[model samples]
Target: MSFVPIICGKRDWDVEYAQSQEYNAIYCPNCHNYKVRPVKRREFITIWFIPVMPFFWGKQLVCPICNWRQDFKSDEQLKKVLREQDNIRAGKVGG
Candidate 1:
């Protein structure tokens, strides 16, 4: 009988922001559009097309239109941007 090798490898899993209101305040320089939003990226070990374990995790602001990504140093830094966006939407000047 011929042996069938199992397919195993690393894979990227992305979780987009789930808020009811889409965050579109961040501008994308690459696409020149307001489609930048936060996303959670996880690198996982996959076996037989199934994710086994996550080895790496990160948060980034990404533009879906142009595939632009900006990594955040910390959760606080990311939160600061979200708060600024909220302020901007509220018409608060000089956030």
Candidate 2:
């Protein structure tokens, strides 16, 4: 039998936040639109293009249209945006 070399590398996966709005009121400086949403970026070790182990992770408010991103320093900061989004959805705040 011939031995095959294993390919291991890091990969990033962008995951949408569960409570995020479909189209938030936050404006994207790059896209000039209100198409921002909370997103989680997960970095993983991949073998043959399949994720195996997690390496690193981060959170951001991103625009899917133009790929504009704003990184979050802490969960509280991220939650603040999410709360604003909820207020907008509930008509408590102007969108």
Candidate 3:
């Protein structure tokens, strides 16, 4: 009889991301590119590389070049960030 050992453990962050069109014109401060993309993030638990349960989820603005993530709990919050950033870009506020 031969037995093969299988590694089994829970892994975090099974994220699902989708870019939003609302902030497509926004530029990333770190990379100096107009690539500030809004993404939906979902964290899940995995067993043997299979997602079995979801633990956390949220929306964020991600800079692809810098890999910076800014989290928001609601649509209103995201809109607030967009407005704030736009103001900064317009020289109406100090970033």
Every candidate's lDDT: 0.80, 0.77, 0.71
| Candidate 1 clashes between residue pairs 3 or more apart in a chain or in different chains | none
Taking all chains together, each candidate's TM-score versus the true structure is: 0.65, 0.59, 0.69
Per-residue accuracy of model 2 over 1-95 as CA lDDT, tens digit each: 99999998889889877563443567666878777877788889999999999977888888889988888877688767767756865789653
Model 3 lDDT tens row, 1-95: 99986655565442434445676766677788887777777776776678778776777778878887677788788788788877887899753
Shift in Å, residue 37, candidate 2: 0.6
Quick one: how many clashes does candidate 2 have? 0
lDDT of 2: 0.77
Tens-digit lDDT track for model 1 on 1-95?
99999999999878985544645557676888777888888999999989999998888889888899988877578778878766866899574
Off by over 4 Å in 3: 1-4, 8-21
Model 2 per-residue lDDT at 2: 100
Candidate 3 whole-model C-alpha lDDT, 0 to 1: 0.71
The clash count for each model shown is 0, 0, 0
Which candidate, 1 or 2, would have the higher lDDT against the true structure?
Answer: 1
Model 3 backbone overlap count: 0
